[model samples]
Target: MPRLWDETVDAHRRAVRAATVEATAELVHEHGLRAVTMSQIAKRAGIGRATLYKYFSDMNSILVAWHEQQVTVHLEQLVSIKDGPGEAGARLCEVVTRYAEITRSSRSPHAFDFPDLHGHEHAVAAQRRLRELLGELIAEAAQSGAVRDDVAPAELAEYCRHALAAAFELPSDDAVHRLVAVVLAGLSASDARS
Candidate 1:
């Protein structure tokens, strides 16, 4: 095929695949996950069932793809924040707060619904990157005496992760903010010295 023709074909395929993923998520949200089907997704996506199958093997695959996309988007958003201008401690707090909000607003209300998905390579990689980013920010903050120097940066990163995980179950944004503040307090070098 000609180069232009190939590019067009690839673009069209991406559009179809994106539409299918979006439609599957919408259907799963409207109906329950178990109640959604390939046919419904195909119809809603305005693509043939065969085309939908070409992109995904089954409903589970479609949901996984949708989840992976969400994870990627969330990671990208976090990366942007890490790159933005701010003091190390302020940036770390912003990243933690945003991550908490993301967790609270994630599509799957129940984390156990897709246990296997959490172990997927992309998800694992994204999580590792997040930890590393947090560690770097923690180290910078420690140097500036914004956070405690007693704990290793990596350990503090894990501590922050565990503390922020509570946001997933918190009742309100106020609670999440409070949780962030508490986590920051635990990391505060000034408070520890006082």
Candidate 2:
């Protein structure tokens, strides 16, 4: 095939895959994972069942691919926040706030198995990278005396993660922000010194 023809084919394949992934997520969110089927995905994606099968072996595989894409996008967004214009402490505050916001807003009704999906190796690796990113920010803030250095940065990162996860249960944006403030306060060097 000519180069232009190859590019067109590749683009078409990507479009098909993206559509399939999107349709799968929507179907699963609406119908629950156990109730969803490959046929429904194909119909929603505007592709035939045979074509959908050519792209994914089963609904589970499609869900995994969709989740992987979601994780990658989320990682990229956090990385962008880390690299945004700010000092380390400022960036950390912004990233932590944004992360709490993401967690707080992620409510949805789905019957999918979270441990199976989120515990996938790719998801685990992304989570580790996020932890490392948070650790780096904490280390920077510690060196600058913005946060406590009594605890190791990695441990502090873990603490921040656990504390901020409470945002998911918070009732309102005000509650979430208050939770972030508490997390940040706990990390403050002055609080430790007092």
Best by TM-score: 1
Runs of candidate 2 exceeding 4 Å displacement: 1-10, 28-35, 111-115
Instruction: Estimate the lDDT of model 1.
Output: 0.85
lDDT of each: 0.85, 0.85
Per-residue lDDT tens digits for candidate 1, residues 1-194, read 69999999999988998999889778767877777889999999999999888888887777778888999999888888878998988887889899988877763554456547778888898889989988988899899878899889999999988788888788888988898889888988877676
After TM-score superposition, the amount by which residue 38's alpha carbon in candidate 1 deviates from its true location, in angstroms, is 0.4
Cα TM-score per model: 0.90, 0.85
Kindly give the stretch of ten consecutive residues in candidate 1 with the minimal lDDT sum: 106-115
How accurate locally is residue 106 in candidate 2, as Cα lDDT from 0 to 100? 60
Model 1 ranges with Cα > 4 A deviation: 1-6, 107-116, 192-194
